[model samples]
Target: MSYQALYRAWRPQKFDDLVGQELVTKTLKNALMTKQTSHAYLFTGPRGTGKTSAAKIFSKAINCHFQKDGEPCNECDTCTSITAGRQNDVIEIDAASNNGVEEIRDIRDKVKYAPTECDYKIYIIDEVHMLSTGAFNALLKTLEEPPENVVFILATTEPHKIPATIISRTQRFDFRRIQPDTILQRMQYIVSQKQLKCEPAALKLIAKAAEGGMRDALSILDQVISFGNDEVTLDNALMVTGSVQNDELLQYLEQVTQKDTAKALEILHQILNDGKDAARFIEDLISFCRDLLLYQQMPEKVENDELNVVNDDFRNFSQKIKPEEIYQMIDLLNEQQENMRFTSHASIYLEVLTVKLATRQTTISPKTPQAAGEKLDPKDTIKVENLTRQVKQLQQQVEQLLQNQSNGQSVTATNSSRPKTTSYNKTQVRKTTAPAKVDLQQVYGVLSDATRTSLNELREIWDDLLNMLTVAQRAVMHVSSPVAASPDGVIVTFQFDFLCQRAQTDQPLKDTLENGLDRLIGHVPRLIFMPQEQWPQIRQEYLNGQKAQKHLTAGEDGQRTEQETPGDPKQPAPKDPVVDTALKLFGNEVVDIKND
Candidate 1:
């Protein structure tokens, strides 16, 4: 006999044999015994949870003459034939290969016929989610209304990919992933049956590696058995799965918890060099942290089957780490795992993650009166006090400035009310008088490169950008409009002079604007804020300059024509007052004078 894979040899033969999905198995068994089964059934779940096995078992039990309690006797001729797959009526289809419209049409064509050997004709379509859109449409009618004696069973790992129309027409059963303990017990039974020598820890390692798949667990176990020459060991299981051992995971976690970045990194380097996968290592760490959290939170209620880490060392180590710290570790490791997908250099991300985990301080649970059990570190408390003081200073400055403005005095912030930060020059006065005159040179420079497309793009995200700004900045920006936008800068015309001047000298506002624009548009632009009162004058100046330049150009062209043609010899060109004077001084040989 040819050697068969463990997954195939130890395939579940009955609904009772299915692992970790009592709800699905019990429902199917009830449906079978009552003979109230739907014509079409949809089995959706992760792989290797016995969807196909359950479908096969249903087919045999429905046809078995000696069936009892919805279970097939497996001794009768029809049951034996179906079990051996010799029953012509029970067909198993792999939808991954035969996922064309034509294939579905073929099934549709044959479904109307009566069964040749059994009471019912069965079609089990595996990986049914892989079927083409056209094929799903083709199967829609037959699946919803198959012949009285025909049954359709569709199984898929990804139900989301299956069409809703197809899903709506069938009785759906979602198979869940088999638990590690369930997988562990099954493996133990198989090993004892085969008289194989295997360590319990080795079986546990294989169970965790399976990630809730029975067939995966068996396959891994088979490889480990072969590697150890039919005697499975913990070392062989670890090597086969490319997973780091629990001790290494523990060592790494301890180092990180103790704030030893160098030691943690060194241990990680050794693990990766020993051929342990970086992704798998990260998963192990995440799992370890999760188990530690569970145990710490509910030591008495923690189930033996719920955790992968069940050791004296882990329990003692759990005492050294806080729940908040574990939460942070999980978050960091999960983020690094996401980062690993985009780059091939997993070690770099791991190293970065190590530094972050080791350097992060434990969250402090303060005993303050404001909020009991809330976390507030001393640094955060200091920050809050500083911010409160600054806010008070800003309020005083605003009140003083408003009072001065009402009395028609110069705008100024009292020295006592001024902010400690020198980066912001709130008290600096512009040489130009109060209505906040625009900088003509800057405005003209912006207009030179301004584009309608750039302005429109700027307008699209104006409201969102305002929301992203600080409260004080948003108040100023809300009354402003982005009038002109170039590749390198934006001109914001404000409705008020104080807001404009305030925005001009506010370094934090500038930083916030640049950061927000960079985040939203991928380009940081120089911001120029001006009052709306100055916009008309600046716009008029720009328009007049453009018109004058055009007129001068036209006048020069006319003079060139006069110099070239002698002016039709009948009519003399009119003289311009400005051009005539310039020509009198520079000579008529230079250009003929023309009036516009």
Candidate 2:
């Protein structure tokens, strides 16, 4: 009387009629033939995998008056009524809506009664996971011990949510998503059966877009047929589904591959202004890129259906894009899609994404432009000032290591062998008479002549100020260690915090420190910053200067003192003068030192 949709019209009427699931059908058929069907059944799988349809077929097969070889006799009144959904014995329920405990109780109450007309009363519950916990508990008993004449079939897309108790009593059948080739063959058969006017490429596109869902493919085909006056055409199908035309997407992709940002944005704007949903555009773009990748990796694996529907130009374009580039493009589109969902300014987000895509070169390109490269090189924007700052850090380390060595700290083999690239020496010198303390003023004089104009300007006032400090303070100021240098001046960092704190105590003291540093090196120290915690350790070291003076006296004698603490000792020493001094200075604290 009325035209039926393709999905409804082509609904599988028999187990044999179901496509891409012969194993399931054969299993059920064998069970029916031997009267080995379970009292309860669970069907689980993705959408359009025929779980519900298989349940119906099973019901009809068991109830058919003239059943033969485990198949239903369509001519029988029982089979006819079940097929038309008019049979009282075969009941279908949508568990999603009637998932309360009360509904389950009602089913439980009725489950005990025998079938009125058919041999078995079959109950099919779809989306069974929607059942409440209480409902599942109620269904458990009936499922476990139902009447001999009753059968229960529960179906759900998500099987993991089903209670294990309920699952234990049932024969679970897992349905699989139909393969593309399987769906394509079926679509071709359907078109032939109906004598429908369609292009081969159109059918393949429908199959691929269905994504392993037969119902989806049929639904899309139905829309296309309706829009094309009973003839399902490629153009109508693309328009109905709002899929991007291959050529248009190819043009946008070419611009991106070439890193033409302006052209890409212009094309995207044109598409958006034409009323296409940016979100949908992103979705289609992802699909287009995925197809390109699939074709590139395994050309023989590509299904010929709708892919064949694409014009020659689009096919050529798809070939032009490499698999890696297609992967990157898909990733970008997916990111854009996610941003669009929550963004208040979706259009702007889409615009920015398109511009970014256009500015990205092909993934496999050997030579990348500076602005549009995947990975930026650090050398691209080298700053000489940073190198100078790093060099200063190296100098500080050398000064600190030299101090520790003179104090008899253990020298790590790794550290002793480490190389230096600058003018500084990497050689390990045996302790010599703490080399006649270098004269800070004389050092500045030599530096003044050897240094460049920039260094000379910074050291100008520094040499004059150093002439005033005591020899001890001057010795503490060995090699003005480097700090963060600037364009106009350089930073002189002190080796220890005591030096910095002492320099900061008086205005002239600070000026003396800066001028001496500048005079010896090339830059006046600007800001002095130290690791905050290291400052306290440096202060403690200063307070312990008396110990170093004693150690020097002890070293000058023939009596040997331990250079560093051993990792483990078998016996504790009664007490030594040097050990007592260490205990006084450190007060039971552990000080890590290295030695051979």
Candidate 3:
């Protein structure tokens, strides 16, 4: 006989021999015993979860002549022949290769024939979703109305791709992934049966690496056994799986918690140098943080033996770190993971993430009143006293100014000379009058030359621009709208005055918006923020000024036309003398014509 892999050699031949599918096995066994088995069945779940094994076991058990209480007697000729794949009545098809309509039609044509040597003719189609639409349509009729003594078993990992009509006609059984503990127990039994010595932790590690797949667990165990001589140890298992030891991961986490950036980065470099995958390392770190958070919240709920770290060390570390810090760390790591997916320089990202984790500040707990008498740091105390004296001096200056206002006199220091006093008053007067007037001429000029075509283009992609921002930035700008656009800048008006102020003061938000816009569009125009309440008034005033100048020019042109053609009797109406006189004295165009 040729050498066989562990998964193939240890394939389950009976329903009772299969592990971690009790619900499916028990239900099928009862159905067989009652002689109420359906003609067609659908088994769906994750890979290596005993779907195919259960299908084969059920096929043999239903046809065995010496079957008792839904259990197959493997000693019988029928059972043995079926188990050895020599039976003509039982067939296994890989749909991934034979998923054409002609193949399905061939099966449909063969279903009419009676079984050659068994009670029923069984067909097991794995990966049934790979069948084409036409093939599915061809099989639909046969599945809905199958010949007697004929059984169809369809298995797939993705049931959603299968047609609803096909699923409705068959009895469906959903298989679940095997638990780690269950996988471990099965491995221990296999080791004992094969007369192999293995450490319990070694089996547990293999089980964890298998990720709820029994076939994967067995394959890993088989490789580990081949690598070691007699006994399988935890270190050997870790080596075969290319996984880091728990101690190494724990030390790295310790450096991060202690805020030691240099050591944390060194550990990260070493892990990568040892050929560990950067993405996988991040995944394991996230799982470790989750475990710590769980253990911190409920110690009794955590299985200490299953944990990768020593229980004592885990407990001590949990005490040193708070729950909120762990949450923030997880969030930051997840964000970094998302960012790393789009970049080729994953090592650089991982290094940067390590430093960020190490440098993040831990939140301080509030101290109670009883602990207030503890000695404070001298530097902090000195800074606090200096700030207090400056605050007092400012308060005194404010009070003196208020007193001088009540007495109707300017505030002047008694010790200051007359020249210094005059200089102070003049400076204060200039500060008061600085912002009372604004020259709108420059703004009007910019608006007149603004390109509406560019503004329209921006309006079309405004939503896309907002979508590119982070969630926090989006929330801050949600109430704002782009009201006016210019070639050099865009004027965004906010519904609330405070929101406008916030948008103006937030430099980082402005930079992010600019960068995002530059990526979407070719250029990043300047953003001008104003409150919505003020926008209409400013726009209306500018438009009215423009209209008045047009009307004045029109009046002058009409007068000239009348003088040029004197034969026409029509003449222009006279303007108000007072308005004309005011316009002449001020040397400005008349903005309004009033009636007396």
Q: Against the true structure, whose TM-score is highest?
A: 1
RMSD to the true structure for each prediction, in A, is: 16.2, 26.0, 17.8
| Clash count, predicted structure 2 | 10
Error of 2 at 556 (Å): 94
20-111, model 2: which lDDT tens digit per residue?
Answer: 88889999999999989999899999999899999999999998867788889888898889989999999999999999989999999988
- Candidate 3: Cα lDDT at 454: 57
Provide the lowest-lDDT 10-residue window in model 3. 415-424
Tens-place lDDT per residue, model 1, 1-596, is 99989988887767788779899888888888898888999998888888898999999988887778888888889888987889899999999999998999999898888999789999999999899766876776688778999999999999988755577789999988888889999999999999999899889888888999999999999999899999999889888898887788999999988899999999999998998888999998888787788788877655456436467997899898888888899989989999999898999999999999999977877567555756778999899999999888788777776666566566543475465432223344443347665677887787767766677789999999889776777987889989788888888998878888888888667766765676578777778889887777776677667656656787888744233435576786554434543333234565764443
Any idea what lDDT model 1 has? 0.82
Better of 2 and 3 by lDDT: 3
Off by over 4 Å in 2: 270-280, 303-324, 342-347, 361-596
| Pairwise lDDT winner, candidates 1 and 2 | 1
- lDDT, candidate 3, residue 188? 87
Report the C-alpha lDDT of model 3 over 47-135, residue by residue, as the tens digit. Answer: 99998988888889999988988989988888999888899999999999999989999999999999999999999999999998668
How high is each candidate's TM-score?
0.62, 0.58, 0.60
